[model samples]
Target: MGYVPITPFRRTAEAVCVQRARVQSAPAPLPVVSKWDILSELTEARAAFGLSDRDISVLRALVSFHPGTDLGADPAKLVVFPSNASICTRLNGMPDSTMRRHLAALVASGLITRRDSPNGKRYMRRSRGTATAFGFDLSPLPRRFAEIAEAAEAQRSLQEEIAALRETLSLMRRDLLGLLESLPEECQDAALTLSEDTRRLLRRKAGLPELRQREAELSMALTHVPPAEVISTEEMSTNAAEYEQHYQSLKKESSDSEDDPSWYPMQSDIPGSENALAKKKAEAIPPRIALRTVMSACPSLNDYAEGPIRSWSDLVRTAEGLRPMMGICRASWEETKRHMGQIEAAIVMAAMLERFEEIKSPGAYMRGLSQKAARNGFSAMPMVLALLRREGTAQYSPGRAA
Candidate 1:
């Protein structure tokens, strides 16, 4: 071999060695993961973070199953964290670079913790690296979410039950009203008797029909008058003729009388002397006054129609004063009728409630009791049915006999 350029070769080898040493001492390049790659892995946590699908799915699963811990692994592992066995298993198929990139992503996401192992002897110990398990801490959030969802569903169901109960109660009220309307008019007295349960259900405003009838009868009694039977026309004619004959005889006797010497008429030459005498007697007592006096004296007149006026003068004055009073009385009567109607309706409602309360009997009663219990609360239905067994009507039902 030729010995030429030996110094130059030594110098070039030395320079190559320095360059290699510099490169070896320099920090390694950081791994890069594309947004598209992250988008492929999605999970609830990552979606909340607005991370891509692939990123969140991979990240959340990693945290849930391979959670971070307070400290990294022991120095024996020679890494910041002892890699999760499950993660390692899942990532085993991936290239080393990709696996390293995933770990960096987990670290950046705060899913893993890096620390020095407790057994470290030196402050700058290269083997002091450790990481936390991110999976354990975040694992229960999903379960909590599920529990909240289930509770909301239960609330919705309860709301539905309450709505159904309201509808049933409304229907029951309507049915009770119809029954009251169709009830026998003679049974009104029976229907008015109320139980405590019935009172609670039918408040005071429900008006009924019986009160209206009584009001009608009262109005008629106050305002009506029985008509008097008049005599036949033949008897009135006979009385009129007899009075005329007696009057003519008396006039003739007065004119014919001339026995006494001083019986001369002062107006004997006047043609209307007898007529003038008759007119004077009629003027002394007016027919209008006499008829009014008789009508006032009669006790058969309708007091409600007549009021307290006795004389014609008093009647006219009192009528003016009583117009408003009569109006007030009529209004009061109407108000009383309205209130009484309300009371009747309330009583009917009470009756229905009492009937419903009588559900503790055997056979038909027991069947009804079960149906009512079921309508109220199905969960308590079976227990109520059992307690109210079909031993007898007394045992199963609580109210009047059907």
Candidate 2:
């Protein structure tokens, strides 16, 4: 030999040795394929194939060194013969150590194979009338094209499912917020389960199965919540205007009186909700319900009030003071006052206070009712009457005098 330059040595991995034997013994006969197209599919499904960005980059550089764009011209034939330095240059000056590491990764993944020469160098040889090539064979790539493409398509479908589930969860979250108060007190277990599932999605990259399971659980939880109340924009706007009128009429009145139309919105002033079940015509509110009845229905007033709770004004004042204590926010309290009129809002509060131990969140309770008032005619009489039945007190006949 004239001269042989010193070169770095690398131990042949047993896995690589096994792969080389497999390729020689029974290479998966495959049709010639576009190298770039195979690379594109590999890139899309890299994660599923246990490939990293650097690994793909090294493979890309190796593919570039191949003689043509197509692979599998001859399954047993060698592919590229570029040196380490040349491949590194194509990879934007990646260090030799990094290139070698990623090259090993590609080999282990079976996307490419190493074809080392007798002296561990990559080159071609010619003997008399025959020629042989050796470097990194890309035949393995086209052989596994169908597998890789299938993985890519599956990944795409998984991503789509995740996006769709996220949208559904988002809508459910909005519904939960709107119906927070309206749900029956018994729905806590379902709500809690849904909360935990949603929290997981927010915190991690949950898989498709995980997401679908959560969605199913949330759907079941939602079943416990009241029927979906779809309030239209026009209806909400009309309700808002009607509330404004109630406030104006209250402002115009010198004193609270049952005769005032503002105090009790007529059956016609309130429209039925969109739900057929909620479409039943609302009965006219009694012109006069006694302060004594409210007191009998809610005895807790003695605890929250400083002095004797006498008039509707005194009840309103006491309820206002107790609003903060019950954890009801200003916005909720004000909306309730405006929508239901001061006396009704006050009675609702007193009823809630008596059952405060049973009620979890008073603020949400007030908001749920306020939302109901917008969609339909919500009256405090029902709430008060429910309490009277619980207390075993004589029912306040709506036809009786003030």
Candidate 3:
């Protein structure tokens, strides 16, 4: 501790001396920790500590000169007395000035401490029964391991929370976009303005605070959304007739389509199920796409199906089996089928299975798609094609899918 320089933390060395005296008088030897493991934790928590890569690199080179990976029982051994040239060589020919600057950064971050000898040199002096090594001391690393680990863990949790929020916001944005598209063009309103603002905001990447604010604004806007337009009696009767005609056609396709107990939402077998399904039901346009086309896009669904999904009913059956596995409850699935048609529901289920990992709440997601379908008809082809594009199976375009 000879020729020590005066600094803001000059008392730090005094405190270290007191701690060392206590450590020397302890009943047991100090526990050793892996230097590399500490280095990795510090890497994650570097931003918190205001450390740079070059600072970490200097630390790395210093640690490598130690006998082994662990900072062991010998306290004096922790003081690495490497010359600047030796460290510079280890750092892939870094300039001496740059290395010195990074070393200062490490010292400022409390990851290391300077133990300069008389005349500002780094060396050890052997006395009668004791030795003193003057150099860069990494004893702080082992002492502050817990602090570094906590910082790293906090950073990790923050990243996870941000990721979850981003996904939630993205899902909400997609739903609002679909809803905006469903709105009547003649009706210009706040929802339209909000959608425009949302789109503009999305054009540039936003930070976490901005995202949170936008999410709240979008949620409030959605809650107060006005009805698309009021339908006259003639228009209502015409839409109702179309709904009935489509129901009849679906019934004709499979004799048990309406009566099937398995089809809970479309359970025309139950009294008044038709009224629940028919209310606000714009005519749903089913994507008459082939199973091979769907399978090529979503091969994961094949795992749930016992045999090949050769027909639309097979897809419905397969989707019914696959639905519960995705944490989607029966009631939500039933309502989705009620809002949209059965075939469209099955197609959505297939698309959901394809994107299982990315989607956090399959049930809520399906419900949003259902709401959009109820306002205007939901088309499954767009969802399917989007998935196909993501999977890089570009053979089937929108033109050919029709």
Model 3, span 1-402: residue lDDT tens: 333332223334456554553443333454588999999998888878999877888889999987778875676588888999999999999999999889878876777766666567777788877777777777778877889999999977766665565555545544544444234444324554554455455445456687689889878755543565444446534432442233333332332222345435544525556665364353244444555556655778889998988877788899989877887778767777777767778887887787677665565566666666778866665565455334332221222200
- TM-score-wise, the better of 1 and 2 is 2
Q: Which structure among the candidates has the greatest TM-score?
A: 2
> For model 1, what is the C-alpha lDDT against the true structure?
0.31
**TM-score on alpha carbons, each prediction:** 0.19, 0.53, 0.49
Determine the C-alpha RMSD for candidate 3 after optimal superposition of all C-alphas.
16.2
The local distance difference test score of each candidate is 0.31, 0.65, 0.65
Prediction 2 global C-alpha lDDT: 0.65
Please write out the lDDT profile of model 1 over residues 178-246, one tens digit for every residue.
232233444322322211122223222222333233334333332322233222346434432332332
Report the lDDT of model 2 for residue 31: 75
Deviation from native of the Cα of residue 27 in model 2, angstroms: 6.3
lDDT of 1 at 103: 51
Q: How many clashes does the backbone of model 3 have?
A: 0
Model 2, span 140-226: residue lDDT tens: 788888999999998777777676666666566444433433466567435634553464464456677877777787777666655
Clashes of each: 28, 0, 0
